[model samples]
Target chain A: MKILVVEDEKQIADFVKKGLTEQGFLVELCDHGDEAMERILDQPYDAIVLDIMLPGRDGLSILKQFRKKGHTTPVILLTARSELDERIEGLNTGADDYLTKPFYVEELTARLHAVLRRSSDEQMSLLQAGDVSVNVLTREVKRRGESVRLTAREFSLLEYLMRSPGRVYTRTQILEHVWGYDFDPNTNLVDVHIQRLRKKVSPDKENPVIETIRGVGYRVCKDGAE
Target chain B: MTPRSFRTRVLLVSVAVSGLVLLGFAWWSWQLLEAFSSLSGLDTELVAGHAWLASHLDAVRWFRREFLFLFALGLVCVLGGSWLLAWYAVRPVDLLIDAAEGITAQDLERRIPQRGAGDEFGRLIDVFNDMLERLEVSFNHATRFSADAAHELKTPLTILQGQLDQALQEAPDGSPLQQNLGRLLEEVQRLKVIIRRLLLLSLADAGRIRVALTPMRLDELLGQVIEDVEILAPELRVIQELEEDAWVDADEALLQQAIQNLVNNAIKYNIDGGKIRFQLFRHEENLRFAIANTSEGIPEEDRRQVFRRFYRADPAHSRKVDGVGLGLSLAREIVRAHQGKLWLADAPEGWVMFVMELPEGAGDGAVESGE
Candidate 1:
């Protein structure tokens, strides 16, 4: 997969590029907005990570111009302005995903994959990590070829973690993605839900499919375990 | 008293004093004229002969008619002149009221037109303009400070968070170093939350929160909030008395945040096994929302101050609750920004009830979405 990261801040651009490259994806970095626009029009990339604040043209206008010319590449907006109205504006301007600044690279990668999968025509509805397989369309989960009963929220949470296995998500990220942006930030809801999900999915907690990153968040095991 | 009331009193007193002075002068002139005629002995001269007496009677009748006409004219002139003077004196005050009424939060820089120097109204305008200047300066400072602080703090925090994430990734699984890094990351996350909330409040204080108003089903929003609340506090029993199709014109995201904050507070402050009753209904021209929870109600003295910034009922901060004390303040601000009123209502059964009343149909003709 080819990805273009357009950010004015050199540190962030370099960090994002290094992280994505280490993940085995071909990543290119562009620090200027105009250069990014020219490069985007000149090449075909699978996904684009655009920042809102740039030297010349802003991220919103660039996205607007890209969409006007009928580019369908998945774009994720990176912004420091966490205002709700600004996020809506970004989405309305043909952004496939929105990530506020001070975000985890893993979260960004997860959102990237999610947006790409949504845009691709050959997207599969079934997500499999280990013996647990989730069918997104039907909201069904199966473990070891047997059905598992999960609530609506549990299904959503499992689906989010399964999208990118072996990547850690923070509690805040999980809450924002699964529970929504309005969920209280101070609650232990994530831990409670995770415990419930584990009990339902793995009756014997000795060999759990989901692994906790200590103070971070939960992630699905990369190795498929039975 | 307000400058407006003071000016009104001055006008009234001036009119009364001028009217009394005019009446006194008229009475004195009438007495003087009668005394002068009596001292000139015209009455005795006329009574000396019959012909003289007859002429004197006719002359007396003519003088009486003229004097009555002149007195009536003088009274009309005095009243009219005083009324005009009072109106002239109060004209500046009326202008000031008009100007003040037109000033809104968004237009705080607007000033009243000043009169000439060395006059009362002129001095008033000067003082008002001086106050406005100070306000504008302080408001700008606060707005700028928050924006700059947010920008500065977020950049370093982002860098720190990124560096920590990178280090955690490289560390072997189950390592002691990884555990310490995780703890550090949690602290950073907590700081991030504080900074985010602070920025939110500052923006709200600056009146810079942009709301995208849309017509949405209030019941549906409430249902979603309840679902979220259940996940957060599963022990609390939530009863919903939502009216069907209670549509409201509001900024969906902002209103959702406000309602979520209230529910979160209820769950956070409630005792174990307490119940939360969520009710929604329309009252006249307002859409009313009442969220009542079975908790120890706030003290009567502290009820008014609960919406103040960083005002916790538990001043000692002994409650193990995890909040920076910005929720209620932010909620009230959001409500006020929406032209709504949010207050703590007296609950009959010792429950803490928060009632929000928002004017209906405010979002008419508003753009449904942002571009």
Candidate 2:
């Protein structure tokens, strides 16, 4: 899948492009909204991660232009503003999904996957990784054909991690995905819950299906036994 | 009569009385001259003795001139004395009027002095000075609030940019950069929350936050708050004593925001495994909702200031809980806008309790707004 990242800041733009590329997706970067518009007009991208604050043209205007041109490609808006009004404005302006900036790449990746999956023709109700399976429709989980009980929070965390296999997610990303808009990363809730999910979903707790990419984050290996 | 404003009333009365006296004296002098000329017997006798009268005419004329001169001198003395007395009586007040006109919002430091004689103008000056003092304090508070909001927003943005710059120092592989990028995103969201809240407050300050009043059940509102907080902090136990069918006239959205702020604060400040108790009740023409939680009791001095903008009781100033001190202020504003009162009550057992009271039938949009 080809993705376009429209952000003004060189560092953030490069980071997003490089990260998605390593995940084996074709990536394109533009420094401003106008540049993004010119590039997107020529090449059809699978998705676009657009930042709200951009030079030449703001992301909102660009999003409107794309929608005006009848492009229905999925667009996730990144903003540093967390107000309800701003969220409403972004969604009202044809943004498919909204994520506040300073967000974890993992949650961004996960939300993008979810948005893409949701936009796809057929709703794939099950998200599977190795021996564990998640029922997206029913919000249930099972491992080795045995039912495993998980809290509402645990289910959300597992679903977020399982969506993107072999991709590392930081504690902050996990917190944002599992806990709504009000999580304080200073707390140890992320680590505590990761341990709980390990007990429920991993075949052997010692040799868990979820791998901890130390000093980085946790990831579910795609090659693990399914 | 009732020790009325002497400077205003006395000055008006004096001008009216002086004008009437001058008009009355002029009319009386004219009446006397007409009566003397109309004395028929005296006029005929004076003409008959014209030769004798001519001999004394010069002396009579000299006496007449002397009498007129004396009368003119007396009138001048009386008018001049009254004018000086009136000016003396009203001079202090004229000084005060000039001073009052000079006072403005930007220069609240100007004061009318009680000039030590302890007169009425002095009392007015004292009151005016007190008002200015209060105005200066509130103005400073508002300025500080905006400055603090800017600082809060900038700090997180700086961190996010710094992290991204360092992570992508090389040609980005995306994995190592993604991890740092993720942290940066979280901070940005936090910054956004603070900004949104600050904007909410500013809109409210501008008197532009339109609250849509609708009939709402307090029970459902409190239930939502408890359930949301429980999901966020599962370790805490929350108990609700909501009166069912407790209908209230309010803007459902603003009321919800106020209640959420109260509940969120209680959840954030409470001890681990602590219990939160929420109650909604109606008492004699007022609807009251309160939230109580186990907490380190605020100092007596701090309690009064907890609702102040950007105020935090924690001395360490850690950004852990993400408070810009705008929540309580916003809650207070919302409650006040609903024609209600918001306050923190002193609690026993070192607990903190926040109470909000709304006047019955207040938000029917019929209540006269002080705005």
TM-scores of the candidates, chain A only: 0.85, 0.82
Candidate 1 residue lDDT tens string, B1-371: 87667666766776688778878877887786566456445665545555654556656546545876877787788767766777778888888888989876577899998767679889998998898889988888877788778767876787788888788777766577776776687777767766777777787776777666678878878887787778777889999998877777778767877887788778877878999999999899888999999987788898888888777878565233335677788888888877899999989766999998887663435446434
Task: Report residue A217 deviation for candidate 1 (angstroms).
Answer: 3.6
lDDT of each: 0.79, 0.70
DockQ for all models, in order? 0.32, 0.14
iRMS of each prediction? 3.5, 7.7
For model 1, give the interface RMSD.
Answer: 3.5
State the lDDT of candidate 2 residue by residue for A103-201, as single tens digits: 555556666777778777556668788888888878989998888998777898888888767666666556545654343535556776788789889
Point to the candidate with the largest lDDT: 1
| Model 2 C-alpha lDDT per residue in residues B83-197, reported as the tens digit of each score | 6766777777677777878876546567776677677767776887788788878865674576456545643564464455335333133465555665565556566566656
Clashing residue pairs, backbone N/CA/C < 3 A, model 2: A19-B174, A82-B192, A101-B185, A102-B184, A102-B185, A102-B186, A103-B185, A103-B186, A104-B182, B114-B122
Residue pair clashes in candidate 1: none
Task: Give the candidate number with the greatest TM-score.
Answer: 1
